[model samples]
Target chain A: MSPFLRATLTIAAKDLRSEFRTKEAFNASLSFSVVILVLFSFAFDPTSEQMQAISGGLLWLVFSFASALSLNRSFARELQNDCLDALVSAPIPVAAIFLGKALANYFLLILVEITALAVFALFYDTHFAAQLWPILLVIALGTWGMTVIGTTFSALTVNLRMREVMLPTLVYPMLVPALMAAMTLTTDLMNGIPLGGDNLLWLRVLTGFDFIYTLLAMVFIDIVVVG
Target chain B: MRDRIMYVLATLSAALLTWNLYKIFMILPDEKNQGAIYRIVYMHVPSIFTGFTGFFVALAASALYLITKDLKYDAFAAAVTEVSLAFASIVLATGMIWGRIIWGIWWAWDARLTTMLVCWLIYFGYVMLRRAIDEPTQRARLSAVVSVFGCVDIMIVYKSIEWWRTQHPAPVLSVRDGGGMGPGMESPIYWNWLAFMCLASILVMVRMRQESISREIDSLRRMAHAY
Candidate 1:
């Protein structure tokens, strides 16, 4: 592997390894998702038809918040022992640090999302057996879009005092379009609606947003991370 | 001299606002479907245009700051961004009021409004990000990156919302290209747009001066410490 890829993967692996050891972020996010899911279920009874109609929205909400929760830890880990400063002074490319974090957050969010989806399905009594593939496609695109911006903002806010509040404020707005597209696709799939021209347009938007933002974030991350 | 220009611009803004209000209330014709209440467009649409201008300039300033590493560009970006948010608030307030009067609802998930709200949140996030950090240089650098992304995000929000509106039909009114405005309404829109632009520009200039002064203070403090 090239040096850039090796550096990126090394950072990602380090994060993943540490994450597995403590599981602090993953556990916090999963429980946070559960609480939000449960709270939402209470607000709107699951037995109602309205609940079914908005299940896609509810699921995405959980995913978005959960992802935020996980991403807040992306830089918190580096802040320990002044590791981020060390990494910055090291020979590793800045883009590699960003890509590695994005990748790590992406994987972590997918785990949280999958868990949340299962719980959402159970709570809402909605089945996605037939629509699983399309749902996964939406999740992948949506999560990638979210992680790209979220990880970058996470890094940006690491030095701040109210990082917990800062992360969602920054990430959530950019994630709206992705969330809308993902929610719409998931809803249509759940309703057994085919991917018509209209649906495909949203899919195109999701894909386009993911591609554009990830590239933009990669190019700009060095600026955010470095002085 | 700089203060004198601001005074002149302030006077111009006041005169233009008074004239635009007169034109909107007395001269402009009512919409065929919605009477009287449609006049809110004079406020809402012009503010939206000005906000767009503010945001676009912010994007350019941000890019320039990043490239040139000049505090002036950073100050300009921050100043205009705040001005843009102020205009965005006007858009939202006017839009909600109009929606309430015409559609019998204060809020609707219409595409244009949703996109505006998203854009507002992103810039609000930018401001929060600025407040969170203590280091002036780092804050400016990260903020520039965010402003650039914000500009790009607004475009995506526009396109996504436009597409989303197709699936869920929204009230469409366009003053541009003679699509919605009729007769006397056209000229007032032009004048109001120009007026709002003047007002927004003046606000940006005043705010930019404040930012520059603050930056100078910070640098002066650092120099004092060095002594």
Candidate 2:
């Protein structure tokens, strides 16, 4: 592998190992999502037909909150013992640091999202046995879209005061378009609506959002880190 | 000289604004379908135009700040974004009034409206982000990057919302789509936009001046070890 790719993968692996040992963020995000999902059931009859149609929106909403929960701390971990200063001074490109964190967050979020979705399904009793692959594809695109924005903004707000508040405020607004596309696709697929028609456009939109933002974030990460 | 220019621009904006209101309320004929309620479009379109222009300028200024490592561009971006929020608020309010009457609702989650709203939220957070960081270079660098993220999100939001619905009228100005309105009908909106643009420019300059002075004070305080 090229040095850039190697550095990126190394950073990703390091984050994964540290996070796996603690699972602090993982447990927090998952339990928060479960609480939110359970709380939502009280607000509406999850067994009703209406819930089946709108559960896609609800599921992603839970995941968005879950995303905010974990991303806020993604960089805070490096702040301990001035690890961030050391990392920035490292020989690796800052973009690698960013991509590494983003990739790690992507993997963590997808795990959280799948778990959350299963919880949502169990609560709402919705099924998508026939469209599993496409649902996973949409989840990847949509989660990647949010992951790019959330990861970048996490770094942006990591040093700011009240960053726990600032991260969500900064991250959620950008997530709207992505969340909307994700919700729409998930709902349609869960309803047995196939892709490759009007749905094709939404798929393109979600993918395009992921592609452009990832590229933009990589190009701009150095500026954010002040490297 | 600067004060003179400010004086001239402010007066011109006030005079043109009065004239545009006069033209909209008295000179222009009522719409065939909606009557006088449609007159709200005059304010709605111009406010959004000025706001969007400010936002676009912010994007440019932010990019320049990134490339040059200059704090002035950061100040300019901050000024433009705050001024743009004022205009965006006007657009939302006027749009609400217009939609209530013409579309029989106070708000519609159409493409244009959704983008305008989401754009406003993102930039508002940009301003907040500026407040949370105190170091000069760090603030400038981070907020500029966030501004780029905001601009990119605007396009994504617009595109994603387009997939759902698009109820806002097509571009009616002669500059766009070859003029959706009749020849004479479009001129007032353009006139109003020019007026508002001048007004927004004044706000931006004043804010920039404040920013520079405040930054100077911040550095002096740091030199004195204030905190």
Candidate 3:
């Protein structure tokens, strides 16, 4: 492997190991998802058909909020012992560090999204077992888009006094396009519609968003992470 | 000498806008279908375009700031963003008024309108991000990253929202589409667009001057404290 890839992997592995030891972000995000799910159920109290109509929006809403929470923690960890400064001072390229942290966030958020999906299925009394692949595809692509922007902004606001407040303000608006695509795709998949025409357009949008934001974040992260 | 140029440009833009307003209210024949309601389009379309132009300038200045590490570009970015926010507000307010009259509602999730609001939100985030950071160079660097991201994200938003609007149909005014305006209406629209762009240019220069003066004072204060 190239040195950059190796450095990226090492940083990702380090985050994964540290997260496994404490599960702080994981635990916080999961519980936040549960709370959001419960609140949504109370707010809507939808009948089964109504649930079917709106569950896609509700599911993505929960994940977007939870992703913000976890991404904030992921970067906050770096600030704990001036570890970010130490990492920056090291020989690793800054892009590698960005990819590493974003990769770890991607994995963590995906796991939380899966858990949210299961809980949503149970609460809304809906089943997605048949449309599993398409649903997962939407979730993965959407989560990656969210993580890329979220991770970058989390680092951007890491040193701020109001960072926790700042992260979501920056991340949420940026993620709106991708989340809208994911929601629409989820709704269509639930309706058992094949991907064509409008559905394909949305899928293309989600893919394009993922590609552009990842590339932009990679290019911009060095500016943000370094002095 | 530069001040005289700005004064001349400002006076010219003012004269052009006054003339355009007269043409909109009196000279242009009202649309057969909507009558006077179509008049707001003169302000609405131009505001949106000028706001977009301001954002594009900020995006370019931000990129230059990052590349050159020059504070001048940062000042330019900040100035353009502040002016753009004013233009964006005008766009939203006029849009809401037009919607009320045309669509019989205060607001609807019309794709263009929704995307414009999101654009405003993203720039609002950009402004807040700068205020939250205190260090000069770091603030410049991070805000530049956001300005670039904002520029790219708006295009994605325009695409995604356009597709979403098609799938979920809503009552659109269709004023700009099939109901083609004659030269009488089109002339005022273009003229006002030019006026708004000129006004936007003058405001950006004024704001840029203010930003640099404030920055100079900050550095001078630091120098005095060192003595």
For residues A1-227, what per-residue lDDT tens digits would candidate 2 score against the true structure? 89999999999999999999999889999999999998998998877899878978988889888988888888888999999999999999999999999889999999998898888778778888889999999999999988889889888888888888888888888877778778989999999888878788878778877888899999988878863
Best by DockQ: 1
Q: Which residue pairs show backbone clashes in model 3?
A: none
Count of backbone clashes, every candidate in sequence: 0, 0, 0
Q: Candidate 3, residue B4: CA error in Å?
A: 0.9
iRMS of candidate 2, one decimal? 1.2
**lDDT of model 3, residue B10:** 89
- In model 2, the runs with Cα more than 4 Å from the true position are B157-164, B219-227
- Candidate 3's displacement at residue B118, Å, is 0.7
- Candidate number with the higher lDDT (1 or 3): 3
lDDT of 2 by residue, B1-227 (tens): 87888999999999999988888888889887778887787888888878878888999998899889887888898899999999999999998888888788999878678777888899999889888887778988888888888888776644544465577876666764586675578888889899988998888889988988887887898889965
Error of 3 at B21 (Å): 1.8
Candidate with the greatest TM-score versus the true structure: 2
Lowest summed lDDT across 10 adjacent residues in model 3 chain B is found at B165-174
Q: Judge the docking of candidate 1 as incorrect, acceptable, medium or high.
A: medium
Off by over 4 Å in 1: B166-178, B216-227
What is the TM-score of candidate 3? 0.95
Reference contact recovery of candidate 1:
0.94
